[model samples]
Target: MIHKILNNKCPHCDKGHIYREKNIYFNFRKPKMNKSCSHCGYAFEKEPGFFFGAMYVSYALGIAEAVAVFIIGTFFFENTFDLRILPWIAITILLLSSFNMRMARIIWIYLLKGV
Candidate 1:
């Protein structure tokens, strides 16, 4: 499942891709997702607004990434409370926004697969 998520493969039938592009980073364009699995015909969005939950996941991922950046920056600079890392954190988040969105959606899909 983790492999599938990372590769953007359909959870239902790992053969089919969930996203149109194999790599989404540095493209400066929104990632395009397939409506259903090409191999298994499984729907990506189970219902209307199903992906809304992915927003929460994305937010959590952003927070985690930001915290990690802050911790790493502090350790590198030997300053625990320096505000200089704020811009770096923001930049990291901005750069990873697209990745977080795709990851969040993939994670959300696998998370609810059991239910």
Candidate 2:
């Protein structure tokens, strides 16, 4: 589960990518999904509202990133409140956002099935 989420693949199978382009920042603004999984042929979006739960996954990923930053700065850097650290936080969030979006959607797919 963790590997699938982190790898940004379909939760059921890691052999396929959740996206076609390496950069989702470009694709998400317009929104496009592959016709079928390259490896497994699993459909990524099954229905119109299939990705609503992905919001939760994105939220979780955000919180995790924030917490990780907070902890690392607090313990390792010894400067928890420095404004200079803001760029690090922002960059980390931005860098992870694209991957997080895909992971979130994948997580949603798996969760609905498990329930």
Candidate 3:
């Protein structure tokens, strides 16, 4: 499940890649997705501006991740509202931005397109 989603495989066929670039770490570029699945020819965009809704999903995912950082940071530092942990949270969020972007799109597809 983790492998499939993170790799950005086609949700419908699970065969073709969703993004043109697969090397998330080495490549500094954003995800460039195929317009349709290579294997089954599934339309990735679905409709015009379909992925625009994914922004909302991304925002939700970010909030959830931020909350997790707050909880973990508070527990680790033994401070409920420590200013020191703020930088840590910011760094964590920045480091995971790309992953979050891809994951958020995957989540949006899964939610609207079904698992």
Candidate 4:
């Protein structure tokens, strides 16, 4: 299941892909998902707003990444309460926004449907 989520495979059938072929990590454009599994014909969206919950997951991931950046900055600079780390945290979040979105959606899907 973890492998399936990481690889963006369909929850029902791990052989199918959840997203279309694209550079979701670095591309500025929104990543595209296949409407259904090419191998098993399983629909990606369970309902009209099924993926809406993915936003919360994305938010959580952003916060986690920000905290990680802050911790790393503090460790590197030996400053526990410095404001200089704020910009680095923001930049890291921005740089990883696309990946976070894609990962969040994949995780959400697996959580809801995978065994």
Off by over 4 Å in 4: none
Q: How many residue pairs clash in each candidate?
A: 0, 0, 0, 0
Alpha-carbon lDDT, every model: 0.87, 0.71, 0.78, 0.85
Candidate 1 residue lDDT tens string, 5-108:
88888888789888898685555588888999999998988899999999999999999999999888977786688989999999999999988998999999
The TM-score leader among the candidates is: 1
The TM-score values for the models, in the order shown, are 0.93, 0.68, 0.84, 0.91
**Per-residue lDDT tens digits of candidate 2, residues 3-42?**
6655557655678777666665434353456755778887
Q: Highest lDDT, which number?
A: 1
Model 3 weakest lDDT span, ten residues long: 21-30
Candidate order by lDDT, decreasing, is: 1, 4, 3, 2
Residues 33-106 of candidate 4 have per-residue lDDT tens digits of: 89889999988888888889999999999999999998888887866878989999999999999899998888
lDDT of model 2 at position 88: 80
The candidates, ranked best first by TM-score, are 1, 4, 3, 2
Instruction: Tell me the tens digit of each residue's lDDT in model 3 across 14-40.
Output: 998877886753444678878888999
Can you tell me which runs of candidate 3 are displaced by over 4 Å? 1-3, 25-27
